[model samples]
Target: MSTRITGTSHLKSENVNVWFGERHVLKDVNITFPANQVTALIGPSGCGKSTFLRTLNRMHELIPGAGFAGKILLDGTDIYDPQMDPVNVRLNIGMVFQKPNPFPTMSIKDNVLSGLRLSGRKTDDASGLLESSLRRASIWNEVKDRLGDAALSLSGGQQQRLCIARALAMNPEVLLMDEPCSALDPGSTRRIEETIVELSESMTIVIVTHNMQQAQRVADETAFFLAEDGNPGGVVEFGNTEDVFNRPVDGRTNDYVNGHFG
Candidate 1:
């Protein structure tokens, strides 16, 4: 199976500030994610990179006391608008978490089709969609023969790809990954990185990664965030990946990316 390029869109953030019950986690942030490209958010552990990633599709608000002020726009439309349902936003922006989390009880085939079922979408060609999605995730060849097997039966890397396949089944315009390769081994990480690069040709992608090298390898653009002196997290620098890594304008960005400090 070859890569399937589908939904694509430009995502932008404007004056975005987030608070978790009065504790500000993210200060005013503004960034733009070009269509069919991968943007990486790189920072130290408590810098709120993952928090900002969740805000792209309104997932940040799922936290009990979380609140944010600002606009997250998809194709110029504010996704946080009261009239814009979060479910719809999520449908267009799929997410994969830090760990591989396939539904243990569901078969590999069912796992790929789970999104369609959850979204209440009906399609006559479920089998085709499953195959294409798995292929797009770069895992179809590995699991083609065991579609009826339980999802947990696959290896860790395969499970992660399966999750990506499931997300692709929704035909999301953007894909948000939060340290999707953090728990994987070197080989698995490389495969996931390859999948990310391949997927970017068809969808907008934003990833939160602590590894500067990984960011340099997979990201087209990079944003550096920091939370210093007890201040809230915010982007310190942003630019093309190569420039951000090799010729950062901000001293802090240089320090972080060069292993001097984080």
Candidate 2:
């Protein structure tokens, strides 16, 4: 398969705050995701990292009573504009969840092409798209011979890559991953990390992970979120990964990175 790079776009969150009905989950979160780079959101559990990520593609609104304030811009256009369709926002910024979730009954090829079919996109070169997407996800060689096999036949790591392939097939400009390797074994985690690094060369990626080491390995920039004293979550530090890890301005950030506390 030829090396095909997906187009990328900058994503920015400007004064973003999120709430679930009366309870605030995220507060004044501001971050910028550079095109063709990987930005990792790192923090402890329930720090609203996932919540902030969902807002990027408008997935937060899927929950009843969940809403947010402020701008989520994709390449200078606000995704939450009244005229902007959430479906289209999602199409441009695809998401992969914490677990590997391939369609159990669908063939591997069908799983990869599912996003396009759901979006009603018509393309004469679907097979070509499938090959390229799988290759981009670094799973083409493993599953190419078994394209017609059930997606569940693959191992856990392969299943996750297949899910990524499905997202890539949509030609999304940005990819959001929420603890994508949390459920996989160490070897699988390493493979997923490799895929993340490779994909970052051509797609804007924002990943939420509790694994500090993983963030250090795959992210170019890192944003550290924190929730304290029963208050809402917010970013305490944001900078290049090395700076954030080695020279954090905030004591909280330094504590978290050095395994002092989360």
**Clash count per candidate:** 0, 0
Q: List per-prediction Cα lDDT, in the order shown.
A: 0.92, 0.92
TM-score of each: 0.96, 0.96
lDDT of 2 by residue, 93-208 (tens): 99999999999979999999998778777789988999999999999999989999999999998999999999999988899999999999999899889999999988899999
List candidate 2 stretches off by more than 4 Å. 1-8
Model 1 residue 36 CA deviation in Å: 0.6
All models, RMSD in angstroms? 3.7, 3.6
- Pairs clashing within candidate 2: none
